[model samples]
Each structure stands twice: as C-alpha cells, then as structure tokens.
Target: MKLFVYDHCPFCVRARIPFGLKDIPLDLGFQLNDDEETPIRMIGAKMLPILQDDGKYMGESLDIVHYLDALDGLPVFGGAPDPALVEWLEKWNDVINDLVIPRTPDPVYPEFATPEAIAYFTRKKTATFGDFDGLKARTPELIASLELGLEALVPLLPDAEGASINDILLFPVLRSLSVMDGIRYPAAVDAYRHRMAERSGVPLVSALRASC
Candidate 1:
C-alpha cells in the first residue's frame, strides 16, 4: 500500500486511479524525489510508481495498475474498449516520446517539476529524441499528432463515474495537453476529457490555484 510516485509523472497518474476511485489512503506519506528511488533500487528497477506491498515491489506503471485493479476486483478491460484504444495504449510510450514530451515545458509546472526532476527529464529525453530545442521546434506537428492521438482514444473511454482504468490512463494525457500552448483537441475529445475527469474522481489539476 506504500506507493512511491512523482505527482507529474503520467505513469504515476495512471497508477493512482484505483486508489482515487476506491478512496484508499496511501500507507506511505508524501515521500517524493530521491526518496522514491531508494527502495525502488532495492527492487533493482529504480523506477517511479513503485508499490511496496508486504515487502514486494512492482515497477512498471501498467503492472502496478493491473495489480491494484485486481486487488479491487475490477475488470481491467471489460467495458468494450475501442480497438483504437487498445492499439493506443500499446503505443502510448512511443507517442509520448515522439510527440508530446518534446513540446512540453522542461519543468512541466505546478505538478512537481522541481529542478532535479527537470534535469532528469532533459537528460533522458535528450538521449531519446536528440536536441531538445529541435524537438521543441516541432511543436506544431507534435501537438497536432497529440490531438489526433487523443481523438482516436475518445470513444474507448469508459462511462463509469470517475473510476475506470481507462479514465486513469487518459487523465495524464489530457493533463499534458493542458500544459502545452497553441494546442486544442477537437470538441469531442475535449468534452470526453472533462467527463472522464469527473467520473474518475480525480479532477483536472490546474497550474494556477486561486487563493480563495
């Protein structure tokens, strides 16, 4: 029940869904940053969204989500998911790597993008895509691709009120779009994002919070 995660990681966001919907309090407090990597290293993967349950550790986000979903006794894919969605999740990382991450701001803002986190992202991303500036310059194409990608997913999202694995999966992508400028998903996808947020029990997180 002890979950290690960075608030902004899309993977972590996906992993948080079961807890959010079931309203299970995390056994661990807000342990962030390097603190997360320590125990995860013991598991030999050194990854985020690592769940420590009864001395066992799981690394991958999907694995963590699936494990939690099973514990909650929810069907992981019973809602007649879109065929496009199935393909999309299979290629989700590729989409993030090739299109979204490059266009995203270095710090990602208001979602725990500390200096160290930003540094790590830059280093890793640069290694994957080469020349961060060049990647950023392709914002137009990348953003368009992102929109199309999500549009392809809008139909597959579950109608369950705020609590399906699909809702968890889609939330982070919508969040990433909110961070980018000059990017707008078509009306259907935009509406779908809002409804999915409502149903998943995790509302969209905004960068600027009002004092009130």
Candidate 2:
C-alpha cells in the first residue's frame, strides 16, 4: 500500500502514525504542493494524505488511520480520544496553526521542492493567513500562548502504556510545533511528545530553527 503525503502536513502525519505503530510497511508518495491533478484524479478533490491500495483510493486522514488500524483484525486506537486533551487542542488550534503554518513551507520538504510549488503554497496560505512576514513577527506572542497551552496540556497527556485515538490526533500537531524552537514544553508534555514520536516512528521536525 502507498500513502501520498505532503511531508510537513499534520494530517499527513496523522495518516502515517498507524502504519508506523502497527509495524506495517507503506510506500510513501510525496505529493508536490502545486500538483492538484494527482489528488483530484484520485479522490475528485485537492485534498491529501490520499491512500492508494490495490487499485483503490482513500482520502481523509483519520479515515485512513481507522482503516489501517483494523486492516489486520487488531486495532490500536480502540478508545475514544481523551476529552481534556481534545478540548485543549480545540482551545489552542488557532494559535498552533498561526505558528506552524507559516513555518511549514519554509523548510525544504519535498512538497515545496519547486519554486512554483512554494509559491503556490505561499499564495494559498497567504489568502487565509495574510502575510508570512506578519506571522513571523508575531512569533514571540504565539510562542508565549503555546507555552501556556502546553503547560495546561501536561496533566491531560496519557501515560505511555498503549495507543489511543488521542495519540493519532495529538502527536502530529505536537510534531508540527517541533519545527519551531524555543517554546518551552512542560516536562510531562515534553516526555509525551518524544514518547509518541518514538511509538509512532514519526520523528519531530528538526531541520528548521525557530524563526523568532
């Protein structure tokens, strides 16, 4: 089975988690930011982390996660996501996006390999996010907000015993934040991030330093 992904995408990271944790081998197709044709042809839209398996295609990150979790008749994410963690993410979603989205294309990921691809991403994202430079300038403020949120997240983090639906939902978002440096992660949350990274076999984004 092959999974087409944009490497910096948290949703793509979501789809990758199950395969990694389950010890399933998956071929990765890194889709370019400018390539709408590939996903459009596969799933009739320009969305991603599309999965191709035995001539069939699947879209949506969590759907792919659930399907893969059950593919071998044993499931890893059988429990519902922890409500506190879910609420924490919901509360901080905008802050996380503001900090992470502007930094994603800055890294040398395969999706942004070409100038056109980077331009396409920048243009599209700018429409929603205003200007990248404006966002970069607010990094200190954003990091402050994220650090507070991370502290609140500490008590909510699950123990590193088994996988839950929360792990699928939470790890990718944390991994995306790893792109930025200097935001202080609280002790439990920091350990949870590294633990989940190891368990999911998806390493944190380390290439780019914090833009602030």
Candidate 3:
C-alpha cells in the first residue's frame, strides 16, 4: 500500500495513527505542497492522505482508515461496539474533519507557520468564524460543546483494556488544540491525553514526531 500525505495535516495525522498502532507496514509517499499530478493520479480530488492499495484509490482520511482497518483485521469499532456506537464514531470522524481539523494545527513543535501559511490561515479563520476575536469569543462555547461530546462518549472509550476508534479519532483534536492559546477544555483533554500516553500507540506518536 502507498500512502500519500503531507507532514502537518491533522486529518492525515489521524489516519496514520491507527496504522502505526496496528504496526501496518506501508510505502509512505510524503508530499508537503500541492502537486499538479497528484490529485488526478490518486483520487481525482484535492486531498492529502490518499491511499492506494493494489489499484484501488481512496481520498478521504476516514475512508482510508476504514480500509486499512479491514485489511489489518483490526476492530473498526473496538470489540463489537453497537452499530449505533460505530455510526456515532464515524460521525465524529466527519465532525473532526469539519469542526476540529480546520481549526487545529498538528501538535508538533517548531511550529510550521510560514508567512504564506499564516496568511492562508488568517483568511480561513476569518472566513469560517468572522475574525480571530470572534473565534476567541466562542472558545468557551466550543469547549462546552466538546466537553458534552466527550462526556457522552465516555462509555464508549477503553477502560482497563484498550482504546477504540473513538479514541483515535478524538485525541488528536484535543492534542492539536493544546498548542493553541485561549482554548479551554483542559480536564477532558488532559484525561484523554493521559490515557493516550499510557497506550501502546504512544510510541507511534513518538515516531511520527521524530520523523517530522
């Protein structure tokens, strides 16, 4: 399998984490900037983290994760979670793409913000939520919403055993948010982070950081 991704895209990061956790060997193709031929050759869509297995191609990160999960014989939902629970997990995956990934940066150090990058983010931030102050003003509400989601999902997360797709899809959002100022949700985020720290997948995160 060949995985095409950029280093800092949170969607790509989320997709890659599960593969790392499962120890799935892949031929990684890293592309940081836009390539004219990539979209057409991969999925006919302008997105990172495109996965090619055999001759089949998939574009979205979640789709790629699902494909890899099936191939690796890993539980897509941790050990026979209810269908509704699985649906919710996939829903949250989309929510992460729409609501979280757009707002968060990859949680690595030596911030990758270039002048052009900053300008791009500035425009996107403004267009999405009006202005920086607007985004800041809504932080409390955002945190409250996230807390509610987390609280609702507490039952689905791993306890003494292991994490589900819920954890994989969820943690990076909080981790990415940790890098930002003025964003609160520390308790929920911290609990998840602490759990993630103790998981076997932690080394994968470490490897990813090292590679970056």
Candidate 4:
C-alpha cells in the first residue's frame, strides 16, 4: 500500500497513526511538489495524506484515519467514539490549523523543506493570508487560543494502552506550533505530548526531525 504524505502536515500524521498501529508496510506515494501530477490528475484533489490501496483512492485525513482504524479493527473512541468528542476534536483541529498556516514564517523552511516545496508554499501562503507581517503580529494571541483548544482536548485524549488516535491527531499540530520562537506550552500539555510520542507501535518522531 502507498500513503502520500508531507511529514509537516498534521493530517498526514493522522493517516500514519493507524497504519503504524496496524503494522502495515506503507510505501511513500508522493512528496511535496508541482513535480507530481499523478495525485491531482488521479485522486482529483490536491491534498496531503492520500492513501492508495491497490487501485483505490482515499482522501480526507479523518476519513482515512477511520478507514485505517476499520482495516485494523481498532476503534478510536472505543467501540464507538462519543459523538460529542468527535465534534470537539474537529473544532479544536480548526483552531490549531488557523495558527499553523499563517504564523509559520519562512526563515526556517530550509530546515525541513525542499526548495521546490518552499517556493510553492511562499506563493500559496502569500495569496491566502495577504499580509504576512500582520499575521505574524497576531501570533501571540493566536497561540493563547491554541493552548486553550488543547486544554479542552485533553479530556478527549485516549487512555488506550497503545497508539491512540487521540494523541496521534494532535502530535503534529503541536509539533508545528512548537517551531515558532517563544512558544511555550503549558507543562501538562507538553507532558501529554511526551507520553503520546512514546506510545507502542508509534514511529519515533525524531525520524521526522532528523534534519528533514
């Protein structure tokens, strides 16, 4: 099976969680580039974390997460996830995503991004946000909201003995947020991130950070 992903994307991380838990040997389907036309022409959408199983195509990170869970017979919210918790997570994801795209300045792109991806990102983000400096200016208030979002999410975090969707879902988002200078998470949330990173069947996040 092949999973197309850009490691920086939290949604892509979501897809990886279930694949890791299922012990599936996944091949990289694509990386960030205009160089790859196959995903757009074939999958019909430009999105990270597209899963191609045999000749089948799957997109949407949460759906893919659910698909992986179903494939492995592991229920994320136990036998049936609490509907309210699901709604809450979706809301929190929106909160984290707001800050992630806007405030992540370009100075650090070379640390993990390819030149092509960085160029594409700079153009795309400039168009989307319109005023990068203003966005950067608002980051502190945004970060405060982000922390509150995590605080709300803490109750929904799983007590599962292994890699749970709860932790996997938030890991990359928090990781991305942490990249911004002067960002400091509350001690409790940082502790949670550590515990999630240590889960069984989960890949070492250091691999992604190994000078990507």
> In model 1, which residue pairs have backbone atoms overlapping below 3 Å?
161-199, 162-199, 162-200
What's the candidate order when arranged by decreasing TM-score?
A: 2, 1, 4, 3
Give the alpha-carbon lDDT of every model.
0.62, 0.86, 0.57, 0.62
Report the lDDT tens digits of candidate 4 across residue range 1-212: 78887655667767776665566676865465444576686577777778888799888887877777777665652355556666876776655555666644343433235666666765777787655666667777877877676676666655544555555555656566654555566666766665655542333344334545
- Which runs of model 3 end up more than 4 angstroms from their true locations? 6-10, 26-30, 33-37, 54-56, 74-113, 140-156, 160-163, 181-189, 197-212
Of 1 and 3, which scores higher on lDDT? 1
Off-target runs (Cα >4 Å) in candidate 4 are 74-95, 103-113, 148-153, 160-169, 200-212
How high a TM-score does candidate 3 get? 0.61
Residue range with the least summed lDDT across 10 consecutive positions in model 1: 203-212
RMSD of 3: 5.2
TM-score against truth, every candidate: 0.73, 0.94, 0.61, 0.72
lDDT of 1 by residue, 1-212 (tens): 78776555677767776676666666533333434457456577556777888888887887877777777576453354456666787766565665556544343343234666556666766887788777777777776776677676666765645455566666666765554556576677777766665544445544322211
Residues 106-159, candidate 2: write the lDDT tens digits. Answer: 535778878899899999999998898999899999999889888888788877
Which numbered prediction scores highest in lDDT against the true structure?
2
Clashing pairs in 4: none
CA RMSD, predictions in order: 3.8, 2.6, 5.2, 3.9
